[model samples]
Target: MANQREELDGSLSVDDPILSLRNASVTFDEGNSFVLNDVSLDLGRGEILGIVGESGSGKSMLAEAMLDAIPDPGVLQGEIIYRPDSDTDIDILELNKNELRSMRWEQISMVFQGAMSSFNPTMKVGAHFRETIQAHDADVKAGMSRAREALADVYLDPERVLDSYPHELSGGMQQRALIALSIVLEPDILVMDEPTAALDLLMQRSILLLLEDLKEKYDLTMVFITHDLPLVAALADRMAIMYAFDLVEAGPTDEIIDHAAHPYTRALLNSTPNLDAPLEEMRPIAGQSPAPINVPSGCSYHPRCPLADEQCRSVDPHFHDTGEAHGTACFHWQQARDDIELNYKASVSANPNTPARGDD
Candidate 1:
């Protein structure tokens, strides 16, 4: 949906978005390994798209592909299209080094995980802020002023952070400082890879709240990548679930969180510790995630799936439409959900204490 609100920086958004990944796949080791397979996703002009999955689930690779940061033996296939406006379009995969460099901070900026370690220790914090401005050709006074403003936005003391080195700041402060740096240039889209991964629960909540405020303050379209489902549900407009390197399901955040169709996604939601649910009934998924290098044939999730049958093992599943702009890569979503609902009913009947699965 096109945003009706005023744009951040008073800029205009194209009514139609061409910013999307269409069948984008990434492989390494001379194409011997596929880390991401046939992932197709489109970003709305001003919405947060959350990608969530377990560790080693290719979530990081997906972000790298968006930034065209893959190198050497890594090969990318299909298209990463960027259309800033209706008048122009660029295939991000085809850009050369110089061309890509110009677009990096100018159009898209990324906030890496463990933001504390991303800084250069040799330089004073202020110098790093100044250097970022220098790269964009802004003058010293303006950059410093903006740097202070950015820090203030993240609730950090600008003067202290500017003078101190990266090591002087607490982990959470450093992360907020990093986030400040990311948005200083006012990029259209901000891709955050596990931005709150290292923080404690309270800090995570605070940082996430800050992110939500910043998104509105800047009118930012964000790509929030993490394994934290509830976190994403709190911030993202829409979300996608990845499994075995494939984009398994995606929809509006509430829909995906409350009415999930994919088995893996259901398993994930069930596994989450819900305060409303009886603690004794909450269960984790049955098996460990598969090694990507040795991903199973047909459906990689089949081996661990409780509902897997001969058909699930032998035939690859294609995305089945569940709602408008929502789909799940599962052959039995309809039947599965029905059976699960029946089971939940039976359980509640038997115990009178079972909690219903009320999630995506």
Candidate 2:
């Protein structure tokens, strides 16, 4: 019944969470500015956590941070605590390089965006799978079998896909192959960043269903990262809204779709294309996101928020929770929650699963 977890430290509790990112932030160019600021998230066992945000919202950066995949020149701050099961908890951010490498692909795996482009042009699809499986196994023959089984799981013909190169396959096929490879190990947590970014509407739906089946089949926890809210709501049990490098809102998917509290969340939902609405009725969120180097004082979103006040412009907002895990970073969340919901609901689509509306 508690709203905000006020007393709880940012660590992952072994009881529930498979992975927890606590007060996590990312900065680049030698601490010149933060690309991701003061973000915390929890992915529960067997649950899909959707990270919804815009291009500049650092959703991908947060995903990279989770897997300790941030490249050189970027600095990650704070803790990434992970508990693969009930018996152990480890702070991933503090892990040694070797440990990070070994933990990933074995316990956690990532299905990155641009799978079509991600595969090596020179390597055949089968070769790629064999290499991945062989890296962890001494038995090359057994690894190939596992790879074919994974391909079958994703609805791809194991023989055709393995023999083909990435370029030889269709975009969706290449994507499915990449997905097959990621799940070949059956990692406990699958972190997918925009898995359907390249596919058409039909393929997107196919991938979505494939993901649902994979989660249930493998008993996996999932973190789905994308700029698409409706897509996330379609499969995710819980959702988080990220903006200006901060996690502004976290709640149930339905609540976020129907009763979002943060201004950014409201504006995002309002701006999203309502498939149920004609093109003429659609309206986009006004104002642009401030540059990471030039983030605004106080509430970073105050400039675009219609409900902004003197307090909003000058004093930063902290999250105010509604129940247990649902909360928003907004000074006027209590006052604006109902009005925002009413106004947006009147103008927006109720169904979050409505397929692509094309960005505004």
Candidate 3:
């Protein structure tokens, strides 16, 4: 089945995406060790693509690689094609420093994780906004007006938030400020790296609502990166699952949630608690994710997967399409699905209070 965005929005198409990552890889100085493996995905115009994974799964690195901001000592390779308009296509990795800087906030912007650390404590919020706008060559007077408008759009009191220092605002306020800052330039696409990870449940909920509002108000194409599966599932039109450094699975949000083909994706689902189901049915994924430097050979997930076999342990598996819009890089996806069904039935039967699994 096609994605929700495709069905509802005639302008968005997967075939000619707004952003396309092709064989994109990020590596540090270590030989043969990658921060992000050859990961490729697409972001359609005005669609939210959720990239979810455990920490150290290269979610942030992938976001950095997308914008040619992979930090010093890290090298990025392959293509990151960006389409500002139907006729214009630019490879982000190939752009010169000046060209890249010109494109960063004006076309593609990011809201980094950890709102507290993102701001300079000594500087007033307005000062940070001024710097961002000034860097992009906007005049000081006009910049402040734009900043005020942006803050107001996020539901913050523009004057109060602009006058206060970063430490003066609560965690939630700081996050909202960050969102305001990222969209101040009115970028076509937004890359958010765990923007709500530090907040409480209430704050997270508010941020999610704000994000939805912003997406529609700005007609923004978004890449939302986080470790929270349910949170992403709630907001995203499509989902991508990353493990160790590779993109293990990606498909429509409902499809991946209902019929996850990869064992790692299933493990994550099992680990997450569902309010409608019995708490006893929830199970944590066994074993820790391997460190990037020492990632396991063959399939990186083979070490922790219950469905692993000799082939899975000895050879890397490429993406195998399981449905029209779904793909998994698992040699035993069919077996994994069968096992997941059996386990799910066993758990629900053991606890009659558990809700039946919903359709994808």
Candidate 3 C-alpha lDDT tens digits along 288-350: 998867887788898899989899887888777787588888999998888875224222112
Q: What is the lDDT of residue 302 in candidate 2?
A: 91
How do the predictions measure up, each by TM-score?
A: 0.88, 0.90, 0.90
Q: What is the C-alpha lDDT profile of model 1 across 44-118, one tens digit per residue?
A: 778888899988888988988888876667888878888777778899988998788877766788898886678
**Global lDDT for candidate 1?**
0.76
lDDT of each: 0.76, 0.78, 0.81
How many clashes in each candidate?
7, 0, 0
Lowest summed lDDT across 10 adjacent residues in model 3 is found at 1-10
Which stretches of model 1 miss by more than 4 angstroms? 1-15, 341-360
In angstroms, the error of model 3 at 24 is 1.0
True-structure lDDT of candidate 3? 0.81
Supply the global lDDT for candidate 2: 0.78
Q: Where is model 2 more than 4 Å wrong at Cα?
A: 1-15, 341-360
Per-residue error at 342 for model 3, in Å? 9.3
Q: Where is model 3 more than 4 Å wrong at Cα?
A: 1-13, 341-360
